[model samples]
Target chain A: MHNIKIVLIQTFHPGNIGAAARAMKNMGLSNLVLVNPVDFPSDEATSRAGQATDVLENATVVSSLEEAVQDCQLVIGTSARDRTITLPALTSQQCGEKLVAEQQSGKVAVIFGRERMGLHNSDLKQCHFQLNIDANPEYPVLNISQAIQIVCYEVFKAGQKQYEPQIEAYPLNDDLNRFYDHLESSLTGSGFIKPSHPGQAIEHLRALFKRARPTSKELQILRGMLSSFDKE
Target chain B: MHNIKIVLIQTFHPGNIGAAARAMKNMGLSNLVLVNPVDFPSDEATSRAGQATDVLENATVVSSLEEAVQDCQLVIGTSARDRTITLPALTSQQCGEKLVAEQQSGKVAVIFGRERMGLHNSDLKQCHFQLNIDANPEYPVLNISQAIQIVCYEVFKAGQKQYEPQIEAYPLNDDLNRFYDHLESSLTGSGFIKPSHPGQAIEHLRALFKRARPTSKELQILRGMLSSFDKE
Candidate 1:
């Protein structure tokens, strides 16, 4: 559970951070990372954290979402709106099992975006799977801390059950991002993608590759093929 | 489920009432009976309810705990402490599944005790099952609304109307096979795949892409990438 980092991106409230810490600790999770929080070391957050203040004390703070999940093999972004057709989605239960299983191999991240606005398209692009919590459509919005509680609860439940550790050595997030960058450049140089057109063609390509979730060796092969195209 | 009710007993916080209403609405539960809430129709509660203000507006305010569950056939009490041994205890997951199934026959209720003091022995006698949310023993007590959120989330999941965020249209086998042919020739044209080594390299690449099951649009992107390589 320690390898499963709960990454919060640009959180608006200090209280939510405290509540999130409490939730994570209650679920037997210890890792907590904050990306550009509005306020930290606040009284309000500490007060809400209860006896789980230890989780808040040891939290890692970073400047960007990319920095928070750089070493992770799987980055799961939670989204309220269903926008990214490119990324595969996981239910909360599936997300819990996936996180627990993947954590055995390497660090895995479940990212929570800003309270007011959800994940930016760029941040969404970084995620391997989009975690969607099932709720009533009429009022699907759950408070940020509450959302964290539900996810952590599911994680705790999953942790209690036995799981076979994931055997696949997946490419890390940094490497995956670099590969996407190389892909875009190579496609542009080959005239398969136009600068003016920008995204649809590239987005489709990115989605295809992401949905596939290439293994490290497969990623290497794809990269080598792209490099050869670059030479031409 | 309309037949399912969330009965909060002697709630002290005005904010939690609103939070409970939002949690109930989010989980598709509409019946909320507050047993002698310290504050009713408070601004804090209304604000916390978000789009679920309707649930709060329609909440049943009662004088006593007995009155709240008088009409309900089944009552399940939630407790922070595991004290009741006489009755069957259900994990939160089981509680949700049980509630959903039992609601079909008649009315069912899940009870939450006060913030500071949990359910009394007298209250425990009224409930058929005691609901327990499994958490780290060090910080087992959750925020009132957070507990409600977990229970409601499980109930919503038990309802079995999960959402599919992305409905991908995968490529047909014939189209996928044709794209594999194009990919092999393109890699060979670019000299990334040596023709003399034959099918081994192509075979591995095919297995990777086939496992990915790229959508029809992605297959088109692949084909276009191959076309660009042919030009190179």
Candidate 2:
């Protein structure tokens, strides 16, 4: 993740730079390259960064986006999907996965443009792919840090593709059946269910519980409460 | 879509509320609810909200999480996995799919807790599930608004999937709350709840019912059944 650079071009809001740094750090990416930011080393950026001031402190400031990503094997620029500039585009998910997969081989970058106007044509040309974040066409423009956030989140997920399998323990059929039986008997005792006329109420409850797929501990709690009700 | 609510609880930063509004709007989510914010109607929030100031303007301010999501059927809280509270959990992807699929039936919510402390145990109990955005374990915390960005992105993607709702519309939070109230009263009448010594029993039941997420018709049956118990 460190090999991938988050390059921002002439960012007008220092807070965005700070937010972007925080976004990158939260996702485990540390390389930050700023291309002629309007303001750098500002208190606003530092204040917005929360705990990620280290990323900003270590940032590499360059004169141009070209110079920032010059040594990178791949560069992905973010833009609205319907922009006039035409280029091979990667969705934010694709950008994240690709960067994580390919970052080890060489330096890589995912660049973001200025706040109001996105990347210029020249900036887009320097990229191997334009990254399109999924959004409503009516208002596709995303705040710069928010755009970085989506991209960074994707990268984080892709990098952890082999995350440890879930360790949650679900109830066995016997316990679940016991729970259902206890539930039915208790409800019958409480007059919530009648003995002779079983209807769809239990079925609906069953279906809803089935979808939830309770863990073993949760099932125990359910059974324990029902047993207490029976004692009453 | 319009039925989805983005609820923020007691946010200390007004800028975050604004950024959250922008994040929600960027992904076509409009509903924003604030539960006892430290500051609102501030220039900082509006300035940060960008063109999404309308979302902030139309935001609902409530005193409690219970009030904020009273009308929502399914409520999801955003939190790290290592919290003291436990609930049925969903990844950001699943949270998106579930909310989109079930939203047509009743209002749904995705909640964010305070910036420093995250959601409280009381808050977690109100939720059927918790949303954990994948991130570096060493530093999994994301800016409140940035987390909103990722969740909304997944939601936007899921919406684009053009999913057909297979499940029946669920009951509104108001009806669900009423059913709970009736259940609690009936249980108390049955000596199921000791007034001086209420423990995890009711909360666990609330969590269970929330997980089941009964439909309006199903809730009616449950409530009707509870009424019978009261009569008995």
Candidate 3:
């Protein structure tokens, strides 16, 4: 995966910062730079981060946007509103492709503004591309952490699949079955399947996608897919 | 754009229908077939669709998948899982090419399974191919409407302005036919396909390949598919 930096400018909520850290970690993106975030070292941020405290602790706290994105080749500003400025705009996929392309040669940073008002006009002016997620117009604004999660998730998916060691790569059928057992147990607790027909339902799901037998990359997608549902 | 039919199978959410319609419309795709939508003409759907009500009203609502995709020459079931079955798999891009190619000469359909459990194994068994959209490891799954948007968006992007008009006269259909014949013969020669069924099967293959009639450059790469499979 490319080393992508995320700069959150003037974040007000500590819980959101922690949640953003968790989102970044989930998507395999760890480089986070906070510009004047309120309550950075608070318990709220740490607790919300869950298992991603390392990201917050290692986060580089800066006082200015220029400092945060100084060394970055690609700068992207996330905004839901159309600022009507003539910035070189790109969709998330375009941004993803562009970032992947640049990763071959240099580093990239995606800069996000504050939660409520988003980036000021001056903040967006310094970016190379603007990413506007096509969200519901009525409720176009997304929670800061939710937005981070979505972006990081896409970045992770764009990376090439990982290869396992040769011995582990060719696992026995029993191992496969054991993995499914673990998956079922985890899913059942999450209410993915009914208790009375756990085997039947899981077997059906297993049969639905048995061809690829799922690499770890695919397993992650399944886990993420199920976890995203946990939000509602 | 290939005249491909989109099947929303057993969709329970009307808002998703609206969003799916908007997605299709934005991509310049018109054909939509809904199988057993839980609610139609709902305020939520119309409100959510915003400007895509025409797509929703014109959508064919059928009671069964057999009716929805009956006239199509190729069928694709979208899944986030790698079902245990040994089905031929295609990425969204490959599927987009195939659908567009088929659209030139015949009909095609892309089927999205039910929201909760997705397509039953039996439902997917009917498809010639399964296309998976890579997503986050934990939440690799996408909302029904979001999936529709992404797939259609890719198809639209693939068909965008990539051609430059030449001063040469329009090539005769026979010239195109000769190229198609050469492609078929080369694909067959490379042993990319099993030669058990000769007549209609080959015709199906021909129609399928023709649907996304390749450019001169793409035609050259199609031969690579044959050689790569040979190595595999």
Chain A TM-score values for every predicted structure, listed in order: 0.97, 0.86, 0.69
B28-110: candidate 3 lDDT, tens digit per residue? 77788998888986888886665677888888889988777666656888998866442456766677676766566557789
Ranking by TM-score: 1, 2, 3
lDDT per residue as tens, model 1, A1-232: 7999999988988988998998888888889999999999899889989788999999999998889999999999998897846478798999998998888889999999898897899898889999888888877878888889999998888888998867778999999989999999998998988898866887887777887888998899889989988998
- Model 3, A107-132: lDDT tens digits are 78888889778988899877988987
Q: What lDDT is obtained when candidate 1 is compared to the true structure?
A: 0.87
- What CAPRI class is candidate 1? medium
Model 3 misplaced stretches (Cα beyond 4 Å): A1-73, A78-85, A88-94, A101-123, A130-157, A161-232, B161-232
Candidate 2, pairs of clashing residues: none
- In the order shown, the candidates' DockQ scores are 0.75, 0.60, 0.04
**Residue B201 shift from truth in candidate 1, angstroms:** 3.0
- Per-model interface RMSD values are 1.3, 2.6, 20.9
Query: B79-142 in candidate 1: lDDT tens per residue?
Result: 9796836578899999999999999999999999998897888898889999889998777888
Q: Model 2: how far is B155 from its true place, Å? A: 2.1
